[model samples]
Target: MGALEGRVAVVTGGTKGLGLKITEAFVAEGARVVVGARGGAGADGALAHLDGRAVFRQTDVRDPASVRALMEAAADRFGGVDVLMANAGLSRPGPAAGLAGADWAQVVDTNLNGLFHCVQAAVPYLERSGNGRIVTMSSALGSRPAPGASAYCATKAAVEMFSKVIALELAPKGIVVNCLAPGFVDEGMGRLLKQNQAVWSTYAPKVALGRMGTGREIAEAAVYLAGDAGAYVNGHVLEVNGGLAW
Candidate 1:
């Protein structure tokens, strides 16, 4: 049997990018997943491959009610939620001086505030699961600080701190909280960054492995944290970077 066999999981922004990979990994490990997304062609298309192991729930993580409904859907469909992948996020790339207010709000609301909503909404169900796991997504940039990614970096850093604090608070309840800090992955925003010649040239040589990390690699880290291997690992930020130096 797979590590996640018999577990029920909810993944926010799960229909695409790294979130999609995590969802797919969890499902492959025998978890029944409820994928939460904002609803789009990409979301629907990506979910088609999961067969019936995963259900798509239109979720705006910024809205607590939407997140609550998503958790409830998992319980109604798969019994109870054992894992919460609070991974929904966005990037508004621009210099701090030139960043637009809308862009800032969009980044903070979806990246930081939205994750809080998901965690709060899922806690009740997760608490009942006995060995619940909450994995929040952050990025290498959370600690690295790039020129045009102030909002994204700040929100991610906040998420890491949030995860640490909550990990302690929720440990007694049998829920283990952790954060995944991926570095220069070849998916989602990182894919766009890699396609830019100037950016790629600047960042590629900095990785100790001399390459970008893959989505599957990050998914494996998620599986490790969510599965039995991570039962004793709490309040940890598992950096899945390819040994980044700069």
Candidate 2:
């Protein structure tokens, strides 16, 4: 049997990029996943290959009600949630000196506040599951510095610290909360960076492995964190950055 056989997972931003890959991996491992995105069509398109193991939900992670609905839908469809992948995020790249106020707000709202909304909505249900797991997304830049990504980096950094604090608070409640900090990944924002020759050239050699990590690699880490293998792991930030050096 698969590691996550008969498990139920809720993954936000699950319609594309890293989130989509994680959803696919979960389904492959025999988990029923509720995929959430702001656009219904995107959600539907992303997980169309999962057969009956996954469902699409219209969700705006920034809204607590929408996030709550997502968790409730998972329970109504496939029983209570065992895993919560708070992966919804966006980046508005610009230098801090000239960044637009709107861009900053959008990044902070979706990356930080949105994660809080999902966690708050999922906690009660997770508690009832008896073995709850939360995997929040962060970036290598969360701790490192990047010139044009101040807002994104700041929100991600905040997420790391938030995950640690919450992990401590929820450990006694039987919920394992951890953070996934990826660096130079080959999907989502990382994909966009690779398309820029100037950026990719600068970052490629920094990875000790000398290449970008794939979405599947990150997904595997997610599985470890959410599965029985991670039973004793909590309040940790697992970095899947291929050993990036300064």
Candidate 3:
């Protein structure tokens, strides 16, 4: 039996990167998992690897109706939701000064508004669990400003505060809300790092560990906060950045 034994969880954007890693970790910890993605996680049978341990649902977190449908499916299939990894949204666009008007809006709408929709939709089912937990994906960018990454930073900053408010409001109901922020996952951020090896190389030493972190490492952090160990750890913003910012 795993730490999340018998619980049902929803991991958004679980097709790849940190989201997929987190979903895999939850399943390994004995949870029934449901993954969400914009158009499924894989392009060519990438999802088949999970076998039946997980299932993918087409979701657009930015759309309220789509989010509601997603929650309905989870409730009907898994009976109710115990843990919700509100990990949807994108990490694109660009610097505050460089991004087009539409690009900025897109980033904010998905990263901020979209995440809000997931939590709002899952409230009813989470309440049914009688001990709900919402672990949202934030970023090291959320903690301190990283140059050329304003959109991502803004949304994440909002994510931390929003989850805190949620924690305060839902504490009376036995629901925990927290933020999971990673500096850069070795797997998913490959493109960003590769695009700017100079940047990564320069900052490598700052990580203290002298390297980037793996998806599993970030997933482990999510698991800690999602399970019973973090029951009392509410409204907190966890930094899994290899001590990069501290």
Candidate 4:
């Protein structure tokens, strides 16, 4: 049997990019997944091959009600929620001094506040599962600052600390909370950043692996955390950055 056989997982932003890869990984481990995103635009095209193992729900993680409905949908459909992948996030690149207030707010609202909403909404269902797992997405940049990624860095850093605090608070209820900090993977925002050779050149050598990480690599780390292998791990940030020097 698969490691996560009979488990139900809710993956925010699972319609595309890295989130989609994690969804696929969870499903491969025999978990039914509820994919929550702002819209179903990418759902049908991206998740059609999952053969009903993955379902999509309209969700705006920044809104508590939407997040709550997402968690409820998972329970109503799959019996109960066993895992929550709080992976909805965005970045508005600009220096702190010149960044627009709206841009900063947008990043903060989606990356940090949205995660909080999902966690709060999923807690009850997770508690009911007895062996609940929460994997919050962070970034290598959370601890390593970049020239024009102030908002992204700050929010991700906050995410790490937030995960740690909740791990403590939620342990008594049998819920495991952890953070997944990915380095420069060749997908999503990382892909966009790599398009600019000028920028990529500056950051390439810092990675000890000498190459960008794959989406599947990060997804596998998530699987390890959400499965029985991670039963004893809590309040820890798993960095899948291929040994980033900076």
Candidate 5:
């Protein structure tokens, strides 16, 4: 049997990129997946080829009602959520000096506050599972820094801390919370590097693996976290950086 057979999972932003890869990982192992995004906004709609294995729910995570509905959907369809992967995020260029107030607010609200709303919404369903896992995504930029990426970096760092705190609060109830911090993940987001190679070239020598990471590569770790293998692991920030000194 697949590792996740009969389990139920909710992957936010599951319609594309890392979220899509994570969804595929879970489904391959036989979990019933509920994918929620702004609905059909990701790659290939991020829903191609997984017809019977997953269901899609339109979710604007920043809204509490939308998030609650997405979480409740898993129970409605398959009887509760076993895992919640808070993976929806946005990154836009806004210089620290000239970044508009709204841009900062939008970024933080979506990445940080939105994650809180998702966890609160899913807590009840997760608790029902008797054993639940919450995996959130972060970036090396949070520990390091990029000149024009203030908002993204700040949110990621906060996400790491958030997961740690949540893990502590939920541990007694058998829920484990963790963060995955990737280095330079190229889930086609690397397309930007073609014209802007100089922007990230300095990171080349330090990337010990000598290349960028992919969505599937990152998902492997999520699969581990969602499995029993991670039972004793809680409040951890597992960095998936390829020995990259970012």
Candidate 6:
């Protein structure tokens, strides 16, 4: 039997990129997943192979009501929520000196506030699950400084601290909150960065592994955190960066 057999998971921004990989991994582990994203469920048959193990809900995590409905939909469909993967986030790259206020707000709203909304909305159901797990996404840049990524770095740093704080507050309620901090991955935003050879050349050597991390690698870390293996782990920020020196 799979490690997460019989569990129900809610994954935000699960329609594409790294989030999609995590969603697929959860289903493979025998969990029913409710995917929430602001956009449509990606290129038509993206999730068809899951064979009905996953369902999609149009969700805007920045909106409290939308996030609430997402959690409720998961409970209504899968019976109860055992895990929450708060993975919806975005980055607006620009130097702090010239960054637009609107861009900053957009990043903060989606990355920080949106995560808070999902956590708050899912807490009631998570509390009832008996063994609730929360895995919040962060980035290596959360702790390491990066030029022109002020918004992303700041929000991710906040996410790490926020996860730690909630871990303490919710531990007594049987809910474990942890953070997943990934380094330069080979997909999503990381892929975009690699497209610029000039930029990639400069940052590639920072990874001791000499390569970007894979989505599956990150997903496996998440599974460990959310499954029985992580029952005793809490209030921790698990960095999945391949030994990034920077």
Q: Which prediction has the highest lDDT against the true structure?
A: 4
- List where candidate 5 sits over 4 angstroms from the true fold: 41-45
- In candidate 3, what are the lDDT values of residues 18-119, reduced to their tens digit? 788888899899888887778753522655666676777888998999988888887778888999999886766576777888878888989899989999
Q: Please, what are the lDDT tens digits per residue for candidate 1 over residues 1-107? A: 99999999999988888999999999999899999999766766787888889889898999999889999999999899999999899999899999999999999
Identify the superior model by lDDT, candidate 4 or candidate 5. Answer: 4
RMSD of 1: 0.9
Q: Which ten residues in a row have the lowest lDDT in candidate 4?
A: 39-48
Task: Write one digit per residue (lDDT tens) for candidate 4, span 90-175.
Answer: 99998899999999999999999999999999999999999999999999998998889999999999999999999999999999
Model 2 quality (TM-score): 0.98
Q: Candidate 1: where are CA atoms >4 Å away?
A: none
Worst 10 residues of 1 by lDDT: 39-48
Please give the lDDT score at residue 96 for candidate 2. Answer: 98
Clash pairs for candidate 4: none
Q: How would you encode candidate 2's per-residue C-alpha lDDT over 1-246 as one tens digit per residue?
A: 887898999999888999998998999888999998897865676677889799999999989898899999999999899999999999999899999999999999999999999999999999999999999999998999889999999999999999999999998889999999988889987898899999799889899999999999999999999899988999999999999996
Per-model TM-score, in order, reads 0.98, 0.98, 0.94, 0.99, 0.95, 0.98
Return the candidate ranking by lDDT, descending. 4, 6, 1, 2, 5, 3
Superposed by TM-score, candidate 6 places the C-alpha of residue 130 at a distance from the truth, in angstroms, of 0.1
What does candidate 6's lDDT look like per residue over 1-246, in tens digits? 887999999999888899989999999899999999988836336777898899998999999999999998999998999999999999999999999999999999999999999999989999999999999999998999999999999999999999999999999999999999999888899999888889999999988999999999999999999899999999999999889997
Name the lDDT value of residue 60 in candidate 4.
95
